[model samples]
Target: MPLALVDCDSFYASCERLFRPDLRKKPIVVLSNNDGCVIARSKEAKAMGIKMGVPWFQIKKAYLANGGHVFSSNFALYGDMSARVMNILECMFLQAYEVYSIDEAFLDLDTLDKNFNLYKFGCHVKRCY
Candidate 1:
């Protein structure tokens, strides 16, 4: 199987920004289940020394001081973004595929001829969403 796992660098933070206009340029963190801990942090947040999996209460002060936005996992928002991204993939490939997660998918592109440029294909995928 010519499968590829295309993981986004900071998927949760990116997904959060999809709907929250104000979060685009700021540091952001997504908490884990029950909003108990930090599961994801943006590059901006990481630069501030916010470690992943830190308890929310422990980081509350730092988060606020650093202008970090904290969001509980909003599966709905992530799901919608995932769908939008996958729909873009569906348009480019010719065969069966399965959405593995909100940010990943497996597509069978066996039918594409030798002329298909995989790098350009990936770039087009990146641009689509």
Candidate 2:
């Protein structure tokens, strides 16, 4: 059996948007501590050319000029959401797994039957979210 890894992109921004569905299609950026830098950016924000780790002040003009949304780093909210996702993965899919980060995990797939279809499993996982 092969192991699998699951990682969420723009994790901090994604968690922030979970409570603000209005921002789903809008560009959103989550800043680092003290509102210093761009730590996480949604796909829309990336499309707007907001590179990760750039100081917020440097891009303030461009970002605000384009009506982008900015958010402070919220580790508590992100951690809670990550825990919910991990619990769902463990209880519904993996027999054993290791959390690689707040937004990544390594799942043991040995317990799955040999005939399991990986593509179908991936689609199922996506639907779970």
Candidate 3:
């Protein structure tokens, strides 16, 4: 079966940045509850060598020194953003899609047009965001 997976990478940081556009293109990292660990990181943050699950204290000084933005985990916002993506998928796929996670989904491409250009279609789906 032809299947397609849609995943929103850096979902938590992406959600945070949505609210703070000033931090767009900047390094961003989301911390777990109690500000304990690095849970989500933006592309910029990852480029700075911040690894997932690293204790906050371990990288705080250097990260801030390089102008990284830190956000406390905000699950509500992330869930809402995820819902938006899922809604778009539902509209596009009808009932031929299954939600994989808050940040991921799967679509049954075999149910789509037989002449579908998978690469072009995938590009369109990605640009839906």
Predicted candidate 3 versus true structure: per-residue lDDT over 1-129, tens digit per residue: 978888897899989988888997999999999999999999999999999999999999999999999999988888899999899889878999999999999999878887868889779767854
**lDDT preference between candidates 1 and 3, better one:** 3
Mark the 10 consecutive residues where model 3 has the least summed lDDT. 120-129
Q: All candidates: CA RMSD in angstroms?
A: 2.5, 1.7, 1.6
lDDT of 1 by residue, 1-129 (tens): 576665666889988887887776789999988999999888989988899989999989967986889889987877887787788777766456777877887877675677988999779767965
Question: What order do you get sorting by lDDT, best first?
Answer: 3, 2, 1
Query: For residues 16-121, could you state the per-residue lDDT of candidate 2 as single tens digits?
Result: 8888998878999999999999999999999998998999999999899999999999999999999998997788566588899999998888877779888997
Q: Estimate each model's TM-score.
A: 0.77, 0.89, 0.90
Model 2 local distance difference test score: 0.89
| Residue 94, model 1, lDDT | 41
Question: How well does model 3 score by local distance difference test?
Answer: 0.92
Q: Which runs of model 2 end up more than 4 angstroms from their true locations?
A: 93-95
- In model 2, what are the clashing residue pairs, if there are any? none
Strongest candidate by TM-score: 3
